[model samples]
Target: MEQFPILLGAGIVLLFVFWFGFLSLKMKMPNVILYILLGIILAKWISHHEILHFASEIGIVILFFLLGLEFKLKRLGGIARKIWPAGLLDVFLNLGVVTFIGIWYGLDPFYAFLLGGVAYATSSSITAKLLGDTGRMANRESEFILGILIFEDLVAPIVVAIIIGLSTGEPMTLFDSGILVIKIFGITVAAIILGKTVFKKFDQFLNKIHDEDFKIALFIGIALSYGGLALWLGLSEVLGAFLAGMMLSDVERIERVEQTVHPIQNLVLPIFFVYFGTTIQFVNGVPMLPLLAILVFWSIAGKMLVGIIGGKLYGLSPRVSFRAGLSLCSRGEFSVIIASIATGVFKIFSGIYIVLLALIGMLLFTRAPQMTNKLFGKPVKKKKGLKVPGS
Candidate 1:
């Protein structure tokens, strides 16, 4: 508990950062990048002391849980046909491309596979922000992108589970992956049942309290309880949080929950981003120009191909599809999580520093709307009687 002061101070600083950072966003910049930069600077000033690691981890867990809450299983079900095809193609194709590159870089087959998997996921946070920023949340193109992202988010944990099983070297096979899936399904069903039975009643009881503070405490209790259960079940904590959120999504108290949680989310989520920057070692005194160039090119091109194929399959116009692919190419927090798993848990991979550098480079280049527009051009406007791609 000696570290409590540092943790508390960090939380306060994060709140300030988020407040100012969001203000910066209104001036046409990304708060995410700003938060990351703040984290990096703080770490450098302190020489990378483990000051914010614990708080940052909590932030990530909560962020993932909130992600799950926003899952909208029903909405995803509506677009399953288009989403599944595009998502599968996106993941596999991106995997194949990255795997080949990994092999070319002299990584072994196992490491190559891990690298490919890491590269396959799109950044859900970034996608959400982009859609909101462009006012395209309701557009067809936006729907396609969102569907693909949501599908990726749902499937990512399964892939992570498979990678974890394989890394353990305990007879990972098709049967094992299947069994893992079954277990996850079982856990989901149990969570839904228990949540519906016990949590619904508890939440109702809390609703009768009529005190805002008590209601907020009840909301946190529910999120933490479900999130804890998920971790205990060997599932991602985010999955549990998501399930909890979904259960409460249609509740009358959802608006209150959102309001009470908003400040906490704003404070913690940025720490996750900043800690991401601090974790990057920037080894060998920063990557040289040649290696950086190759990584950036491949990262961009790999996603471009996935986007094009996805767009074509969805019968979108060539331009719209190309833009969609370009827009989806940027890898953010999810990629970092994959890299950490590769380096820390798997031990089968060695080029994690390089991957991290590559991802950061990609993030630096792709974290803005202007870069996206420069790459894909602005959405085409259609005549009054015609349909626009996003419209």
Candidate 2:
């Protein structure tokens, strides 16, 4: 294949993405799925490109940062409280139950646990975008969905770190684990303190800036910087981007800020999904077909159970809980991240599983409201015609 200049390649990719986006609108499909398909089709050329990877990261970070702007410190705390029970249930069902199943199927314990990690985590990127696209961001179950995603984000890195340690024959010590915990705590506290103090005065400073270009640069810079800080601390950049947004929650000109951020996010976010698609290779073909089937079934079941049971614990009504359950079944980036560590058949298995669940999850998400309404929505009474007496 002839190599195009980086600039030309990027332009072509973006144009393809635009075409996909147009089709998504016409078909009423989620762009996430479409972008991934585009990636798979172009995988040979674009696979493992560093520029693509960095651009994708920027897309996701901005998406989460926008999400954080909607949630302030107090609201975030309240959400954490309501979500902890569901969060625990999510871990038990998705991680614990899936791992147990993997072990029962006679896989090595370490690999089984790795499989469990793959099954865990609802794709925050996909879920967040769906919530916004479907206009469910303010819906009752959105809180539950976002809370569960956040909980998984916090837990998954530790799982990955442990797995990496074991994979390298040097398991993390208690000291290492403790240090990791402290880093997480430290970042959280820092975000909260900054939000309460520095960003409280940030709005006025923004008002003083006359140059729109400078303002846009500064706003995006803060988000990227904080997200980078999270990565530096060996944590997920999504968490950092979110906290960065929370930090700026104190600003009064949130509307203006969002206007500045949304176009950039929209422009780049599709590349992330496409890049995700480019990573999946089917070298060994599908392996352990039966085991894969069982895991897929349980992966869906586990997340549904978490949504139903955990949503109740989180105080959602039965119907809404069901909706939440259906919505939470998709796995994305985190699953891919964990799965990328596997070799041979395991990698193929993880790729197939991720693609399947992501497609299924998005479909379920789109249909949840209709399904819930059918199941639990109040029945409509048919009125008798006044002319029936004449009949």
Candidate 3:
């Protein structure tokens, strides 16, 4: 019976998340920022629920799995061509700058590297949500934004694996890192090949399911199963889920899978942000504010700089380039995931830093066309649009 309160409390928090999300829709703010704030406000109350923690992990795996469903090798190849320069830009300017800033702030070199990573990847969840919400997915700049995001998503597993390994044991040598890379590549190749063979078989079975609900259940189970298998084999479960998603991307009537999974994502994704917010210990949070400010600035400006350079490479105008940078402003899921693995002040800094960046990213996304229009010529307005955001 005592556990009932935990469930009740969770339901209440989710209710607030839903309410705030509705309000944010009108205001054009990200729902994720609101969820985090709610979590922070109720942190003491929410901290004890083990169920929510597990749910949040499920949320992460499912979210990434769905993100993977959106692409195949061919689409990914196309995106790779468009994004590698900006992705490299994200690596050099956006990523490296923050690590330097972290060291300059007197953090240990290792901790600074972690901070760099924390700042490096923008939140695909938030950005993709925003793009979908505002109907900007078809925009030229959005393509660049998504390209950078997908590229980051692909790289994140490697970074997370390295950090997790280091935090648990002795430092890795260059040779060890090389071996890890090869291992991951091997897993990826295996997943792709396996997906091709398995999903083809699954599709044949899928056609036999006449009931809609059953089909949805089957698809979710398959994704989770593949994802779990991936984890068991020494890869990130999220990566495995992604591979599972991509495996069936080319399957007949896959849009049904996409639709089925979205509602699940919509429900679970907020739990992740809220749980992440609860993890932030605000007692010593003030001292990290200065560092947070610097990270937030780089998260926006660095991306903008990269966008300008990248946009030019694509023969886009300064306005479009600037918008692309703006699009990259937000960081969400990965940032929180990184912080969760760390202890002490670094974790606190990362948690708050992501919130700050998310808000900034939402602001930039909402105002993108307006900002561009102020200096450059007016953008062709897309009628009847939602947006890409965690909002």
User: With candidate 1 superimposed using the best TM-score fit, by how many Å does residue 303's alpha carbon deviate from the native?
Assistant: 2.1
| Candidate number that wins on lDDT, 1 or 3 | 3
Worst 10 residues of 2 by lDDT: 379-388
TM-score of 1: 0.76
lDDT of 2 by residue, 308-383 (tens): 9999999988988999999998889999999988988888889999988999999999999998888888636788
Q: What's the TM-score of each model vs. the native?
A: 0.76, 0.95, 0.87
Clashes in predicted model 1: 2
Candidates 2 and 3 compared: the better one by TM-score is 2
**Candidate maximizing TM-score:** 2
Candidate models: Cα lDDT each: 0.63, 0.89, 0.76
How many clashes in each structure? 2, 0, 17
Specify the poorest-scoring 10-residue window by lDDT in model 1: 345-354
**Model 2, runs deviating above 4 Å:** 378-391
**Candidate numbers, best TM-score first, in rank order:** 2, 3, 1
lDDT of 1 at 209: 79
**lDDT, candidate 2, residue 229?**
99
RMSD of each: 5.6, 4.0, 6.2
Model 3 lDDT tens row, 146-194: 6777678667766776677777777767886786678667767876786
RMSD (Cα, Å) of model 3: 6.2
Better of 1 and 2 by TM-score: 2
